[model samples]
Target: MALLNQDSDENPTPGPPRTTEAQYVASRSALWSGVSALFTDGRGRVVLEDVDYRPARLLPGGAIDAGEAPSLAVAREVREELGLTRTFSRALAVDWVPPGAPGYPQGFPGEVIYVFDGGILAEGDFARIRLPEREVTGVRCVEPALLPHHMGPGNARRALAALHARINGTGPAVLEDGRSISPTCLDDLEVLRTPRKPQLWPWHTGPAPDELQVRQSWGWLFSEDGRGLVLIGQDTGSACLPGGTVEPADHDDPARTLRREAWEEAQVRISDPLYLGYLHDDTGSQPCARVRYAAAITDWEPPSLDEATGQTYTRLLATPEQAAQLFDWDSQAAPQLAAVRAAREELGLPAPVRQQLTELPSHRPIQSPAVR
Candidate 1:
């Protein structure tokens, strides 16, 4: 009966006997990808979504559905999440994040993320953000510096890379594990370190032109070809423009203060410094207003050891895009730099060449006390 029967007791009817050994799985990788946007408002603050599940924030995107293109996925996400019917900017960055990458949720189902540039949204556009009550709790458009505070390290690095790509006019920046693999990445990218000293941030307080206490001066220096000059500090390894505090003896012109400091520190003679704008230094115990000037640098002298910091300053040349990256990305100096660029453009000045990855800091002047 067993030999004649079509179905056996141990084996299912008309099928091969089940094996005790585990079924073989294909030795292939199933990587999932998604698209996100670095949406900025007129003020240049990036848009982030705060979720209800965890404290970590995220860019406005989700997993790429099967049979969907990345670009299409981003457009869908923005429309669904932010309720905006729109097109996406060029792909600003493409990152290959492994499973369990920082910024991904538990059960993150992907190996790559495509970050797109969602060009600056006006204030009206910012007000248009409507969150899906089930997923996101609230939305925030804040300065780029606070990205790390809101999002995970991986997401922050990738977003910054996308910003760099958009500002410098470079193609998508490629990265792995929060570090860039592309050769054009910024030389002084401060992604590797954590805050050693606490910044005394007053939370988006714009500079008070009339109610300032101290006066400091910095120069917006350019080369003959119009590339900007950047100074990298030896002691702190921080990037800053070449300039310093204003003394009572600096006379009526803050540019003279810059000139004196330039000569003393970098050993360069500053040409005529036209005041671009002023930045409020709000990171210290004492708040001050910083005066900025735009000028050309000439007659270089080898830098001496900075007596104050006891570390030697390294002088380097950078383009406008480069200078923007070299400085603190979310500093008040950003507006001054933009003003200088605008004035130059209006005057038909030569444009600078971006030698490496660009950085996009916000150009929107901080309008109100808490509007940043």
Candidate 2:
């Protein structure tokens, strides 16, 4: 046979071609990652750092350096930016961003983000912060619902989701483009999307004076856990407790009105309502009282249309503090605290803490209940 070259076999080995390590790495796409910390003021407000380079503020953190762990990267950034030494173990959320996002220049690779909980900061912790001379210009503590006014949309979404994740305590929220891939009922309902209307009206404990007309009935309805129920108006986007205007069928009894309205709006049956107090509504031409009650949920029926709104209201559960914050009642903290205390005592529960709003799951839809 004719002499064949040593390397001239008719068929090459059927396998992928081998390459140098450098060549292999170069063949794959490259991406970067960033880390952030969600620090709260223990009063339901998030800590945001104002940066000189960026128009919008951000949570305390920065990019991961080459060959650095996500946790280490955040710790380094916190030390460099805030002059504080802290370690983070809890991951609240992880978000994946694609390239070409707003503010990201062309040719920049996409990035992954890890958000960690910094725990609630006290007054002393605030005193310890030392901002860098050039990079950071200021710092602010803002309510979660107001984050959009201070941050870019994506950053706000990420931060809000992270806050919810921290409160959920179930696990980290997996996200894409700052939105949860699998969202909770609260997230699905977009609770707190609208800022609560601030009310500075005085709160009165015990029954209203006979002269003051009882115009409305509302409650701090509670679940087995220490969470209170909040109803988001389908038309107005405003949040309020599950109660409504006193109707004739209610027979001038605010408690009866509250029980009926609660069932109609939320399809939730509550125990005998305990009188909490009332809010003096003198904003309009006529002065009247908006009665408030505290009750524990006994049963949850299937979702149904709220006859008053002609739609199903978005029902969410939040801690007493979270409810107060959502109600914009922080300024009148005493009354909010009082209501919570009375409610807990009535239910034989412990003190409530700040937590993420959660969904009150309902089964299949049912026909709208007849309005009483």
The candidate scoring highest on TM-score is: 2
Q: Give the alpha carbon lDDT tens digit for every residue of 191-288 in model 1.
A: 21222222222222233366775377777776556666666665454567788888888875677888888877777786777767665557767787
Note the residue pairs that clash in candidate 2.
none
> Each candidate: how many clashes?
1, 0
Residue clash pairs of candidate 1:
164-358
Model 2 Cα lDDT, one tens digit per residue, 1-372: 122234665764556654556666677878879999999875668899999998999999999988999999999998889888999999999998878788777887889999998987878888898989989887789877889999988899999888767756658999998999999755676656776566666788888999989999888888877788887766554678889899898899999998998889899988998888888878989899987888888888766888667877778887766666455554465665677677778787556555557668775345698999
Off by over 4 Å in 2: 1-14, 19-22, 199-216, 223-228, 234-238, 245-253, 277-291, 298-311, 317-327, 331-372
Q: In model 1, which regions exceed 4 Å deviation?
A: 1-28, 42-44, 100-110, 183-187, 191-214, 232-239, 248-253, 275-290, 301-304, 309-349, 354-372
Compute the lDDT of residue 116 as modeled in candidate 2. 93
